[model samples]
Target chain A: MRCAEHCEVVANRPVATNQFEIEIHCPTVALHAQPGQFVQMRVQSGYEPLFSRPFSVFRRFPERGNFSVVYLVRGAFTQMLARKKPGESVFVVGPLGNRFLVAQPANQVLHLLVAGGVGAPPLYLLAEELVQTGVPRQKIVVVNGARRQDLLVCQEHFAELGVRLRTVTEDGSAGAKGKVTDALKALHGRGELSGNRCQVYTCGPTAMLEAVAKFAQKHDLPCQVSVETLMPCGLGVCLGCAVKVRTANGTDYKRACVDGPIFDATEVVWE
Target chain B: MSEVKLSVKLGPLRLQNPVLVASGTFGYGSEYADLIDLNRLGGIMVKGTTLHPRAGNPMPRMVETAAGCLNSIGLQNVGVEAFIREKLPFLRQYRCAVIVNIAGDSYEEFEQLAERLDGVEGVHALEMNISCPNQEKGGIHFGVDPEATREVVSRVRKRTRLPLIVKLSPNVTDITMTAQAAVDGGADILSLVNTFVGTAIDAKTRRFKLANITGGLSGPAIKPLALYMVWRVARAVKVPIIGMGGIMNATDAVEFLLAGASAVAVGTANYVNPHASMEILEGIEQYLREQGEKDVKHIVGTVKRCKPGNEF
Candidate 1:
């Protein structure tokens, strides 16, 4: 069941430069939330910014009855959200959208997780779930990229999970000096990725996702992407978050809020 | 303290309250069932249904503006057949009036839709959505011209005995002309000021925010304009008016009642607050008690005008 509640903020602190992770106490949402599912948050009471913004559930602490979201302070909504302190109440509707595919224990598929900038939250959660599900720690490789060093979030979190971590930066402030796709090529050159045995999961900016999708398609690797779009009402009614995908007939639009924020790369029609 | 009567009559159709959820915003009523009591609403105007399904517009279909939002959803729905087959049964459990909002690409489609749903169980009325600004055909085109508006409403009016409501477009030279035209064509009620056409631009990217380039603007920003139009139309036509445009709370809802609207529909507010319509309904009753009005009807079209010598 989905819930709409005014949850009290348990903790809200900056995890990286210009990025903050805020946890809210809502047992129903926290316990039900899965990787790639998100919550719609109302930043303020008034209509300065009228619509609620959708944030991915980065971490779920069911025992504490809390779920955290990692967000970048890009616009007015985020700017206001960053100032929210512990004990402040924020209206949130959650455990929405579909979740990413978790590897089965019996399967021997190699899992490659890729994340860019603030997009690391959901992927990090996916990595944690994979490790818990008995996917070997060596089989799970997380490639994290950002514009600079500080914007790269969730690297330490993924490291703490005892999985392989690869970092890439556009300015070369840290890790390899290149895009995430460049690091993937290096991994492929090292024979770390196989066509039929590997599965790729990515979340990031549109440009980067498009590139990642192309690479996954070229290698015949099964890929799932977590897409981010402007959504008015995260609950399926608004129909504002549309993502075009390939259909048997030709192409059709699907709601990213409900149908998925996570979609198979083969089905998505990249612009 | 006296009891406040919230029930209102819109032509032959009557509502338990005067607060109905606008079409497209409420979905099939099941979407909000988990959040609020569906039986408490005056009515539930489900999403716009057509002769066939629609894929709608491309990505970036919505954008946020100051105190409002713009959307070009293109009336995407599962057609009338699917609506009756899949969506209606869930609504039958609720006591609220089930008003099917229908949109057509032509006069034949409109007539067929009305005829198809005329005797359908649980459907109390039909709200003709001729004012959707996002569609390429049959939407704003029919609403902009008074002759087309009259022709389409009259065509559907003949096919169904259900109370007919003609939703009017705000993007017109004079809204009164279309309101009178709908009434002249046998409309039982009027829902005014659908949405004002607007656009948004991204300064950094130097591109239109919406994929459709221009979308319809709906929210608190258009409240005053909508109130003015409803007041103007109420005097021009005898039919009861369902005023809507950025009505966020009970105060805004009551303002429409005083401005000549018999009832009001909660549109964008449903998205902002899932329980907005319920709160607005409670607020209306509270306002009635505070004003010493026993019936909500007592306050309809009661706006006082300033006299020549008494003007401030």
Candidate 2:
């Protein structure tokens, strides 16, 4: 674990509604972090708020040797962080928390991914890794849903994958005019998806995850979900990020930071 | 390559390392065990306990803003008896020092709790949490008033033979005087800073983000405040000081040691990065090698003040 020292915030630009991306010039983190991990960064010039905000690594561009975080304005910490302009630097703690499991499943052919709204960051990372592994673009199908076009983030970036993008929006602002799970059903009906043979990975709102879990159960698909819990310390010491999990032996809860921000969808006991 | 061993000896107890997890940050040392390497730390300072189990405060118990976190975790530990029965044996296997942090609502409760914890085998040390703010106890008793702080430390000193380390609260106006008062009352060591009281507002709802309305803020935002207080108290006190507040890494710990801290504790850093203490321990060793220093002991109180002509 390392804290941000002289790392400068070289770029801060808004990409969506109340959502912005900040590229921090932290060479150490840019060099070390993989796809699914995140960093906790704080803004310097502000009397309005106090506390560092945790954001997932949206993308880590090795060519430029910098990593970026895409975040939404939810609390005072983020609102303040989002307001930070170019040239100002804040402290950061990284490559913190365990990352998603991307090991190639033995005898596996399909990688089904589901993402919702801005929670698409980690899954996009998984997709990027899958692309690099030479998985056929046709085998990687992304079913992403957002409230509207304003909330539908990163679809353009995913489009560049040359893979199929199936989308749904709660409001008919863009894509399919229903929910993501509804689009998932459409895929199943059209024989585009056969859940029994695929390994599913998802990241989104808890409700959407529950919906995916229900689908995994019905089809007996092996599914893993990324869940979010209240984080005071992005470190494992706080015990604030416990989530109930059911394993083959028994069921017990584990921390999101250490045990996982990612878990088997069937194992998670969402309270 | 030099092995970065985190263990150190202070007095009666040989701490596995100087990287003891801070109190209030680590729950009973058993709450999140499987996630961390308990043996890696210097010791474990379980959350502040009393004679009775407390449910603590209401939710939203925590909120993050800027470079700090605000928490109103109102001393929520499962009392002394339950700890003796359940939490104790679980921690004994870990092969690290265990410091039990105790808080009491009254002087009598303090004495009783100390008496009970006296012979607990696995309990390596006793961290006196006298700095806990009690709005109900005459508007400010143990933490704010030096008299009350001294009295509590004095009474507990008579009851327990365990090494006493009094944790001081910085909510008071003069931290030095309060520190001295605890030392005079027979405290062997001191831990500075419980959280500084703070609040975060929800402008959309026009209400407080935390249900407690105001909470104690920790993390980088309070690093300067914590550092200044540690330096201020270190100058006025003789007891070994365990400096803590916004200490997240080895550099932060170095700053504290330079300011006269004998040891340092990692608090909110645990929340942001669970592997913080180990990283800090490594960071300290890296600094020592770079500075051509052999032992970390020499760095304590080495913060050289810049003279008028010393400006380069």
Candidate 3:
């Protein structure tokens, strides 16, 4: 039951460097939102930034009928969204796109979740879902990477979930001084990552996603990636977010709005 | 409470109303089934189709602007055979008219596509997309030249009896010449104006915003420019015109109607609101009832307040 409604903001606060989280009382959207789905939101009434921006659903409070979105202040629309006061109305259309699919083969599947900078929200929510669904917290590993320590905002959330958390930053201001893919390599060297029974999930920038995809392919492990694109309308219409994917016939286009925001890493045509 | 005639006659084609969803914006109709009532719209123009499949342009294909957005989709579609086989059957279930928008690199490609779809069931009309650049010839050269526009439309017109609508490109100078040319080419209806060519660059990154440096601009920013073109073409040719560009609301649709357009297509507004077409349709009906007009046709080209300037 997707819906377009004017949600009232409950809290708008800075959670990290240049990143802010907004919680709104949108019951319909909160009820329908899954782990990897997103919402198209427009904050301003005027015609500037004429298109709605797509944001992944960071948190959902089904009991209180509220949902949260975390976004980095990158442009005018995001700046406007961050400046919005509590109790202000924000137009939102959600819970859109295909969600992250869990491929649990017996009880041997190890879920390796990866997050890159602003792409953390969806993967965090995914980890939460995996834990709530009876997957042992020890079987799940959360990997986060950012430019600096200030940008790693979801460390505490993953810790509270009792999931094993590993982090890396480019500037050595965080846990490990390298990329998340580096941490992945180290885990594989230690025989922690298995090609046979482990499943990988990630949400991040295209470069990072491509690296993860290539790594998973090399290891013969299955991986699912939540991609990001410019989507004016989160629904299947607009055709604004066309992503190329490898099909049975050849390479073809799929709309990121509907076909998936989440797609199997092997199927993505990384050119 | 008088009965208002919302039906409109566009040459040989008759629409239940004057509000239509533009091509490229609306993806084959099923994408919007849950958001709005499909039967309420006058027509549905699916994505642009070609003879073969297209992968479209690279990523970062769209960017937001002031009151508008730009796109370089490069006409990404599954081609004609797929549409007739896989897409058409689904569209047949809807009550609204299903209009197929086709593009090509040459007159022969256009003719072949039109011939293939000539007797296809559920295809209500064929929109000849001359706005696309001719891949065989360089530049946005086909639709810009009156001769090419005439030949393409005439060839397509000969192949399809289902009403032919020649979509004109707005990049050309003196749009009337092209409008008159399309009518001469046997176009039943003329739909204008396609997106205007525009570009945007990121000052900080020192790079273009879109993967394709120049993309088609659509939305509320171009409404005034589209209105003037529709009005100009409406006065030039006797064939009915389907006006579109930056139509966001019912008032914009009414403005196009008053400017001599028989019908209007909601393009960029669809991206803004999935239910925009239905809202515009309802708005038109409400406006007609409020104005005490029995027929929407009465308002076509009815402006008598302004006189022609003495420059002529």
What is each candidate's DockQ, to 2 decimals?
Answer: 0.73, 0.19, 0.67
Measured by C-alpha RMSD in angstroms, how accurate is candidate 2?
7.4
**Candidate order (lDDT):** 1, 3, 2
**Residue pairs clashing, model 1:** none
Distance from true position, residue B112, model 1, in Å?
1.2
Off by over 4 Å in 3: A248-250, B133-140, B304-312
Q: What count of clashes does model 2 give? A: 18
lDDT tens digits by residue: candidate 1, A1-271: 7788799999999887888899999998889988888899997888989999888889999899999999989888999999999999899998889998865442477788899998899998888888887888888889999999988989789989999999999999989999999999999988889643888899999899999999989987888999989878887888898899999999888889889999999999989
lDDT of each: 0.91, 0.77, 0.87
Compare the candidates by lDDT and give the number of the best one. Answer: 1
Model 3: which docking level applies? medium
lDDT (Cα, tens digit) per residue for candidate 2, span B1-312: 654444555655577656777887877676446456787777888878889976566555678767778777666567999998998999999987889998887899889999999989899889988776432333235877899889899999999999998988888899998899899888988888888888899899999987667778778788889889988888898777888988878999999989878788988877655566778877888888888777676777789887998778
lDDT, candidate 2, at A255: 64
* Residue pairs in clash, model 3: none
Interface RMSD values for the candidates, listed in order? 1.0, 6.0, 1.4
Model 2 bad stretches (over 4 Å) = A1-5, A8-20, A45-48, A72-90, A103-107, A244-253, B1-22, B25-60, B65-68, B72-124, B130-160, B168-312
Best by DockQ: 1
- Please write out the lDDT profile of model 3 over residues A1-271, one tens digit for every residue: 8877788999998887888999999998889899899999988776787888899999999999999989889889999999999989898888899898887652467889989998899888888888888888878888899879987867778889998899999899999999989989988998888654788899989999999989989988889999878888777766678888888888878989899999999889886
